[model samples]
Target: MRRAIYTGIEAFGSILEGNPKKNVIALPILQEVSDLPCDTGSELKDLQIEIEQKDLPVDLRFVEENWSEKSGKYEPTSEKIRDRAREARCWLKERPESEIVVVSHGGFLHFLTDDWEDGHKFEGIRQSHHL
Candidate 1:
């Protein structure tokens, strides 16, 4: 039983340490429809503090894409997503040894993977596949 406990503890430790803690680039989403009710600026500030506490870098940017008020939905234009991916790809490419955390909307993440959809479906941005 003691041996089993030790093994379990070791496994948990490995799981925690295996993943590299590094920079995270957050993607901007609609504040009105986000999970958090707080403003984007406040959220960003909080996220920055969390990243700092975790000994990681917080590198974030807002996509320059604007949606039409009349349409009441995001346009099918890939420019914004493309721009975000470009930035992420550049950072990842430069530092092949480091791990990056991208905090963005589900749609933006999908765009990074080149799999855009009308609905909010998450297929996850697999690091290995993209890098």
Candidate 2:
């Protein structure tokens, strides 16, 4: 059984700060490439920088999703989110018994999980929790 750690963007810093593990993975939106103010890139970059500065022992990897030109959206359900879900499912299939930590936007996190339903919303990052 693979344990997943889903968390929003802003809290990634504090979460990594507290957790000293070396096997964490970060999932970022592929189509949405720019690090805009409230986008995934910004948050991921922030966490990356923090990790570098703090010299934490966590290993980070990103999962990329294809973008849809017809929809003109980064994470439309049928396109980006679904692709990410497939990728995660495939990864889980190969390694079905690993604990993975994912730092990404709330919507993407929900899309990756089996328990989350549509229309679910998560507030922006507030505080980070330690493992």
Candidate 3:
């Protein structure tokens, strides 16, 4: 998680080189809304601190819902993933920013973009599907 967070910060830094006020938002890795037992908010909180310490000219925001994964163990279904993805897509469309940078995990990203064509090729360690 630490490595991922650092790598994300580095990537964000690179993006900032071209545009300092690039709108940035992140999908919760494991937030309060998640049904998962463990949460990654602490690590993300640390990420927020690091962003501040580095003096990066951007405000990182999070989606209220944990749309990254299924709600809980019992509600395991692809339908839910699709619904959440649609919800996320709609929320993004409502944002005022003309160009927003969304930081998210690969699996959920697949759903968010409604693209499942590259499933086989992106198997294992493929964490990004570029927009």
* Model 2 local distance difference test score: 0.44
lDDT digits (tens) for residues 1-131 of candidate 3: 23334546677767656675563445443122223433234444566677688765445575333333434421224545456677778888898878766655565577677677865423432233222
- Candidate 3 TM-score, C-alpha based: 0.52
> lDDT of each structure?
0.39, 0.44, 0.50
Instruction: Show where candidate 3 strays beyond 4 Å.
Output: 1-15, 18-20, 29-44, 63-77, 120-131
Model 3 Cα displacement at 43 (Å)? 4.1
Clashing pairs in 3: none
Residue 60's lDDT in candidate 2? 52
Residue-level error in angstroms, candidate 3, position 73: 12
Instruction: Report the Cα RMSD per candidate.
Output: 12.3, 10.0, 7.3
Name every residue pair that clashes in candidate 1.
27-103
TM-score of each prediction: 0.37, 0.46, 0.52
Q: What is the lDDT of residue 31 in candidate 1?
A: 20
Q: In model 1, where is the ten-residue run with the lowest total lDDT? A: 31-40
Residue range 13-96, candidate 2, lDDT tens digits: 564555655445543332222223344343345556776885654445552232223133443434445665667667666765
